[model samples]
Target: MKKRFDIYKEHYKALISLGLPIVIGQIGVIVLGFADTLMIGHHSTAELGAASFVNNVFTLAIIFSTGFSYGLTPIVGAMYGTKLYTFAGQALRNSLVANTLVALLLTVCMGILYWNIENLGQPEELLPLIKPYYLVLLASLVFVMLFNGFKQFTDGITDTKTAMWILLNGNVMNIIGNYILIYGKFGFPELGLLGAGISTLFSRVAMVVVFVIIFLRSIRFRRYKVGFFRLGLSRTVFGRLNGLGWPVAFQMGMETASFSLSAIMIGWLGTIALASHQVMLAISQLTFMMYYGMGAAVAVRVSNFSGQHDTLNVRRSAFAGFHLMVALGVVLSSIVFLLRDYLGGWFTESPEVATTVTSLIFPFLVYQFGDGLQIAFANALRGISDVKLMMLIAFIAYFVISLPTGYFCGFIMDWGVQGVWMAFPFGLTSAGLMLFARFNYMTKNR
Candidate 1:
């Protein structure tokens, strides 16, 4: 056991170097989300509930789009590993086109959902709050896709710091925007939830614009741009991206759907429950994104190793990543648990919401291990481009298992919001174990 774990020690520094920037960037986004939720919740619980429903709905789209964008990482990582810098650049161009197309498709789908959001059974009073915020967020999808394209491209080449700094700056802009608009400060009309939405939209656009400017002007990216401009788009590259993208999208979409669609269940409970759900969701991002940050590093490193046919180090990289994820999970879960009673009050003034958040913490902490485990191995599979089966596995874990269990617990068992959250551990752990097994089996065969 000691030797088995000892093998992983060699990979920690490399994975941390690659993953830490992503974690820092994700933490910045978390802070932005915290500010948005805090401002909106303090402004009005009604708006908070509306934001919860709308944001969770958008989360499904955002997460799905990000998954599609992830297809670029392995493709670019392989090219980078083999010193094919030009091809890696071409992959970014293709990725941009692919991501934009996905954004458009999602926009249409989200538009349809928007038209029927009232029909989804959320509180009737919050519709006015939900509609405008939803539309503003809908408008940002394209920009988000574009930024993701650039981010994944850079990450594949191991320049994680670029996205890190860009994201931090963008989030700062967002937080500033959120405060001014939400509070009616700085000659702003205090749009509340809509203000938050508009702020997010602009920040997303700025991130994309900044990435483009940097990509075009920076000497560091000159080689990649050579392919970006000269190689043009290729049918094969587009197809390759799609082939890798859709399965990942569905897989990730399913995972997010468990939380997102369940927001509807929480809505059924009442405004307070839904508002609490949103706060919990924001808090969940603290760890989820952090784990994903490490998971992404695993994907990049694993892909780099695979490109060289070094299956051994690929496995080592993945296991090392898992160790890191579990360690992060333990520490974070402990903190959240210790602070559960007071955590919700940090976001909103409502005592009831704070109490509800406290009730949900146990369920939240229970899934951290599974969440981290799944994130690491899922990215490992992504690094190797073994994604199709992952889609199926996610379907089983989230849709077939998690959703039904949530309904049974939340409704059938009359457990309310806490019951809904309890289903997460089962789904995440099952998915994590299966993914870990698959990664091991695939690597051993190699």
Candidate 2:
């Protein structure tokens, strides 16, 4: 017992050492989300609903892009583990190209969606607000992908603090920008939701620029400079990245679709539901992004171990990540539950929105376990390059199970938005369990 306990403790320490910076950075993102929700929610309920729809649509793109960027992590991690500095640097170059292409693809797809925004069944009055904001966000897609590429590279190399610092500062700048523009501070015109969109676009661009400059100029990256500049894009490398990236992207894209699509259903219930859903999503990020941070660490560590053929450590690290995620879900859910009443009020003064937010709390809390579970194992699978299955698992959990459940619950059961939210736990837990089973089987002997 003592020996086993000591072993687990060691894994915990290592995982936390790597994960803490990422978690802090993710918390910064959550803080920014809270600010966005608060600012937009108070600007006007109509704009809030518009922002909700637009943001939900863009989130699907962002999440899919992020997942595609994750393909870079394992590749870089493996190279970093092998001490192939030049190759890792070369891989980063390829990743940038791949990420950019993905960005353009997403941008075009979103652009098409923009062309038909009115057909989506959202309230007609929101079209004016959604259009410009959607355009602004669409323009930022490439920057978002570029940032994700750089971030995944840094994290894979275990330079987690650099991206963490960059992300934190960028988010702070975004909040300040949001304040100045959203409310028309310092003699600026109050553009409302458009202001928020402009601020977000500015922040994302700044982050990418800062990340690139740092990567290019810093002495810390001197080791990578030669390869970064000298390595031309390789067909082999590009193919590998795309092959790996698509599966992960589809996996994550489907997971996000479950929520983004649900936003549509929530929108059908009216603006109050949309506003409440937006705020609750912000609150949900407190745990989701934090778990993602740790899950990312798991990927890095597991990839590193896989590179070294240290199967034991890879297995240990993945399970350790799951344990940590479970612990986090427990702590965060408790805090959220305790503060349920006031949490909604923090976003908006609308009594209806606040009440709706409060009601969604139960489903929000229930999904934490599954959310954490899926994040840990999904990243673990990425580490092992066992990702094609993830796409199918996501489809089953989200499309086959989650979406229909939400529709049935929200409409047939008349559970409204809460019923929609209730479908999450079912989907997430199923995905988690399947992912866990896969990881367990894959590493069972090896």
Tens-digit per-residue lDDT, 1-446, candidate 2: 88876777887998898899999999999999999989988888888899889989999999999999999899999999999998888889999999998899898899899998888888888889989999999999999999998999999999999999999999999999999999999999999999998999999999999998999899988888778899878888788799889999999999999999999999898888888889888998899998999999999999999999998989999988999999998988999999999998888989999999999999998889899999999999999888999999999999999999999999999999999999999999999999999999998888
Off by over 4 Å in 2: none
Candidate 1 Cα RMSD (Å): 1.0
Q: All predictions: root-mean-square deviation over Cα?
A: 1.0, 0.9
Ten contiguous residues minimizing lDDT sum, candidate 1:
2-11
**CA lDDT, every prediction?**
0.94, 0.92
What TM-score, to 2 decimals, does candidate 2 have? 0.99
* Tens-digit per-residue lDDT, 139-204, candidate 1: 999999999999999999999999999999999999999999999997989889998999999999
Q: Considering every candidate listed, which one attains the maximal lDDT?
A: 1
Counted clashes in each candidate structure: 0, 0
